[model samples]
Target: MKKLLKRIKALIRKIFQQFSSTLEPSPPPSYHSPETWIPPIPPVPSFAPQWENGLVLVCSQCTVEQFAGSSHRINRSITATEELQNWLKSRLKFDGLWGKYRVISTSCLGICPQSRVVVVLRNHLVGQQCLLVDPQSDREILYSYIKQMNQ
Candidate 1:
């Protein structure tokens, strides 16, 4: 009984030592200068339109994941499609034309492939319109389309 008790105690100690080693906290790094620290800017809230005229570009979910890629590759959790939508919204907001146009992120619009991001520009006056775009599309083309839609 004495030998058995000794063995059990030794086993328990060994197990605790292994567990404690894993729980050990990492050492703190050497102190760095305050200059080395840079505060991150907080995200701006979504812009709310005052009037609503020009057109709304709906970015579908199908394109969201493909454009965003893995979290490691993309800095913002926002996908490529979302980035485009936000850019449009910001442009309208900064220009104080929030009443003139709006860009919205929408769910899967049934269109997949064609490279991740799909945009549908709808103008009340001109009627509904759709444009399928991929990540590889030229920026100029997108701008031109927007310009034409506004006209």
Candidate 2:
């Protein structure tokens, strides 16, 4: 019994020694002070945005809500999202205009009310007009809304 206890104590001491060695802190680099350090700032280029204008953020996971404060099951949001993208592409007809505007699906837009949600922004600048659309309900209406923004 004494032999077993002694062996266990020795093992515990060795384990603790290994752990303490790992816990020892290392000193920081020899930088001394930040007052002497100078940061590099690149010069601004004379250029504008590669794309023409605006952004379109579509919620790919729009769902229909039966009641308030309940988790929603995803409906035809993917189809509606694809429909909107195709419609926008066909209507725009500008080469690479579709690429300029984002046509991607999102998890949820937080407004689940028996319809798909699509958000459109004319410009990313401050105070731009952002439109929230329901593509499940008359996509033509949504198209017209975007068309107005294009003009």
Task: Report every candidate's CA lDDT.
Answer: 0.66, 0.58
- Whole-model lDDT for model 2 versus the true structure? 0.58
TM-score of 1: 0.51
Compared with the true structure, model 2 gives a TM-score of 0.54
Clashing pairs in 1: 63-116
Q: Summarize candidate 1's per-residue lDDT along 1-151 as a digit string, tens digits.
A: 9999999999999999999999986544447555574455899889755434556656557555564564555455656676677776676677666666767777877776556466777766777777776544544476566656555
RMSD of each: 15.9, 6.9
lDDT of 2 by residue, 1-151 (tens): 9999999999999999999999986544457355555555799877654434555666555532332234664444346566776666666566435644544456666765465464645554432554556665656676665555455
List TM-scores for all candidates, in order: 0.51, 0.54
Could you say which candidate leads in TM-score?
Answer: 2
In model 2, residue pairs whose N, Cα or C atoms come closer than 3 Å (at least 3 residues apart or on different chains), thus clashing, are 60-106
